[model samples]
Target: MKLIAVTNDRMSIDELIQTLLAIEPYIDAVILREKSKTDTEILKLIQKLKEVNFNVKKMIVHGKPTIANTEQIDKVQLPGGLPLPDLMRQYPALLFGKSVHSLEEAIVAEADGAESVLYGHLFKTNSKPGLQPRGTDDLRRIVSSLTIPVYAIGGIRPSHIERLREVGIAGVAIMSTIFESEHPKNIAKEYYDAIHT
Candidate 1:
């Protein structure tokens, strides 16, 4: 249960590398979720990350278990919309986490063999515009229905970590709070401090 931040392939390679390096120390995992990167681009990004001696073991990418398997990364996260195949159960391999916005969706993910689910929008977020916020109470209700770990997402920051901790959430997931910062390292530290507190 820890912070998992992702990088957008939208950034140039240099910017991408810098951001990853800056926040590496505070991150429990880095999810390389670039949607449009060609295979060559993806390979280049992976190689650059390795060159910096970043802990590749703590990395996860969407649907590319081949890359994760070959690179020996920590986990593989699948997009919420995709169906999890029966073959996933055979791996006994890396952690498998998925995103879900509803209790039913959460249940589906668990039934489909996800190790954990990323529950979201406890507060309205720009990334999830127009979606109703599920507040802490609703979040608690969702977590209580599942046996595996649940990580809270959407509008979470250093300030909100304690409330989530109080409710017994396994961890927190953040995206823009760290990525949009000029100093992502400091922001990550702030989130780590809040969670630890």
Candidate 2:
């Protein structure tokens, strides 16, 4: 399975870069989901990342198609409720993804030219406490119903890999786990092995 790491707001910019670089070889991509940062700040960070020659193609800007287009970044993952139809037409070289919660939303996202989707809350995550998990059954249905890649997100752990694989997911997007790990390199390797072996 493809392993994409999602960034959290808790870390400093330098820490973020160090963590991403450490694990880049193990993970497939890094989704820059820094929603708290201003557009200018995000764009600057994107530029700096490119300046450092990081694989920008492996970076997905969250809800920022313009920045993606400007930087020629290949992927953009739209957050929930942000509307921009026919993304393929506007950003021809870019692949768009969406975050969805249910089968209905997943279908809608696929219909909206989203090449991939992130669906979950599959387990009790620290970030989202007191919420019911969507579970593997719904994950199975979502995966079966869509031709596009469905990456399970939220509360994904190394132990969950077998169930996720059985449920037919294409990949996973994990935040907190990689970003907050004291040894991101080892954790990333563990995640990769879990998915592949």
Candidate 3:
């Protein structure tokens, strides 16, 4: 399974870069999901990552197709219900991804031409509190409906990999559990091991 690291608002610029650098080797990509960051701010962060020799291509800018195109980053993840079919046609060069909550949305995304979808809250994590998890059955249903990949997200842990893979998810995306860990590299490695095992 492909492991993606989703960024949160808590980390400072330095800590974020350090975390990205440490975990880069283990994760397939990093979704820069700092939703509040302005387009200019996201662009500057992209520049910084490139300056540090990080793989900018593996970084997916959240909700900013213009910035992503100008930066030549090649991937932009749109928030749910943004109606990306037009954007996908407009920027054929860009890989468009989405965040979907249900099978119906996943099918809409697929029909609308999203290259992939990120789905979940599979087991409850600090990122999402109190709400009940959508669980593996829901995940499997979504996976079954889409030809494009569906990545499980929200509250995922290392121990859940086997079941996720069994359900036919393309990969997993994580947030707080990775960034808050004492050793981001080791945390990423643990997930990688679970994926490859």
Candidate 4:
């Protein structure tokens, strides 16, 4: 299964770049999900990452098609409810992945031509405090229903990887488990090993 690292929006650009550099070897991709940062700031972040020789190709800009196009990064992870079909047509060069919270949403995303889907809060996580996790049964239903790749996200841990694989998910999208750790590289490697082994 693929091990994707998602930015938590809590780190400074420098910290993020350093973490990315350290974890790059283990992660399949990094989603730049800085919702509050301006487009200019996001552009600068990309530039900084490039300056450090981080692989821009592995970076997916969350909710920013124009920036992804500007940087020649071909991947963008879009939130649900947008006109995905129109966006796909507008940016034919870019590959779009939709973030979906439900099976209905996942079905719509697939129909709308999303290349992939990130679905979750599969386990209890601080990211969604007090919100019940969607759990494995729901995840399995979505996985079986969709023909496209489904990446499980939210509150995932190394211990959970085996169970996730059983659900037939294409991969896992992780945030706090890597980014919030004191030893980010080790944490990333742990997840990588779990998924691979």
Candidate 5:
């Protein structure tokens, strides 16, 4: 199972770096979802990660195509509503990711040439409270329907990851659970273990 660790833009660069460092050793990719930081701030953080000799294997920048191009990260995970075709042409060199919430969206994303899709609400969490959990069955169906890689996102925990892997999910993208943990690397290790177990 692949692990995609997401960064919080609200945190200071120092905090963000610390968080990234803690989890980098265990995950397959680091997604910098900087929703509030300016482009310069985001660029500085990326440069800092590179400068420190961190092997940031794969990076998923939220939406900055121009900066993503110059920085040369692995991929760019786009928002749910953006046109993948238009952006794909703009950055043919980078992998394009889509945020998909349903089976139909997953099929559409694949048709639109998305390199991967992050599917969510697999389990309930504060991110989307009071909503029905999209259990393993739902995920299995979506995975089966799409040709592109499917990443299980939203409220994913170490315990739930193994089941996701059983159904052949490409990876898991996580936030609050890993990001808020005191020992995020250890938490990441837990996720890594779940993926392989």
Candidate 6:
């Protein structure tokens, strides 16, 4: 199982860059999920990352197709509601992954030409207080139904990796697990060791 680190939108650009640089070797990719950041801010973040010789290829711009195109990042994770076919047509060189909440959404996203689908909140999390988690059953169903890669997200821990692999997911997308930790490098390595070992 692949381990993907997601940004929590809680860090300054400098902190984020350092954290990402520290954890890069232990994870496969980083999803730049800073939703509140503007386009120019996002551009600056990318520029700074490049300045540090960060692996921009491992960066996936979340919900920002133009930034991905302009930076040549090659990957963008889009919301399920977006017109995926149109985006795929407009950005033929870029790879798109749809963020989905249900099996139906995953199926539709794959048919619409998404290279992958991020499905989640499979476990209860601080990110979604009081709401019920979608659970492994639904996740299993979605995984079994989709031909493209299905990356499970939300409240995931290194301990849950084995069960997730049993569910047939392509990988896991983690946010607070690494981003919120004081020792992100150690946390990332622990998660990576769990997935690989």
Best by lDDT: 4
Name the 10 consecutive residues with the lowest summed lDDT in model 3.
Answer: 35-44
* Candidate 2 structure lDDT: 0.87
- Higher-ranked by TM-score: 2 or 3: 3
- How large an RMSD does model 4 have? 0.8
> Can you tell me which runs of candidate 1 are displaced by over 4 Å?
87-92
Q: Give candidate 4's TM-score.
A: 0.98
Tens-digit lDDT track of model 2 for 1-197:
89999998777677777788889889999899998888888888887777777887789999889988888888899888976476677778878899999999999998887889899888888878888888888888999999999999888999999888888888998897887889989999999999888
* RMSD after CA superposition, every candidate: 1.9, 1.4, 1.1, 0.8, 1.5, 0.8
lDDT of model 2 at residue 86? 61
Q: Each candidate: what lDDT?
A: 0.79, 0.87, 0.88, 0.92, 0.83, 0.91
TM-scores of the candidates are 0.90, 0.94, 0.96, 0.98, 0.93, 0.98
The residue ranges of model 2 lying beyond 4 angstroms of the native Cα positions read: 84-88
lDDT of 1 by residue, 94-114 (tens): 678887888898889898889
Q: In model 1, how many backbone clashes occur?
A: 0
> Ten-residue segment with the worst summed lDDT in candidate 5?
52-61
lDDT of 6 by residue, 1-197 (tens): 78889898999889999999999999899999998888998899999999999998899999989999999999999976889988888999999999999888888899999999999898988888898888889888988888899999998988999999898999999998788889999999999999999
Q: Across residues 1-197, which tens digit of lDDT does each residue of candidate 4 receive?
A: 99999999998888888899999999999999999888988999999999999988889999989999999999999987778989888999999999999989999999899999999888899888999998888789889999999999989999999988988999999998888899999999999999889
Report the lDDT tens digits of candidate 5 across residue range 62-143. Answer: 8787888888886898888888999888888988888877888889999999988888878887767799877677778888
Report the alpha-carbon TM-score of model 1 versus the true structure.
Answer: 0.90
Better model by lDDT: candidate 1 vs candidate 3? 3
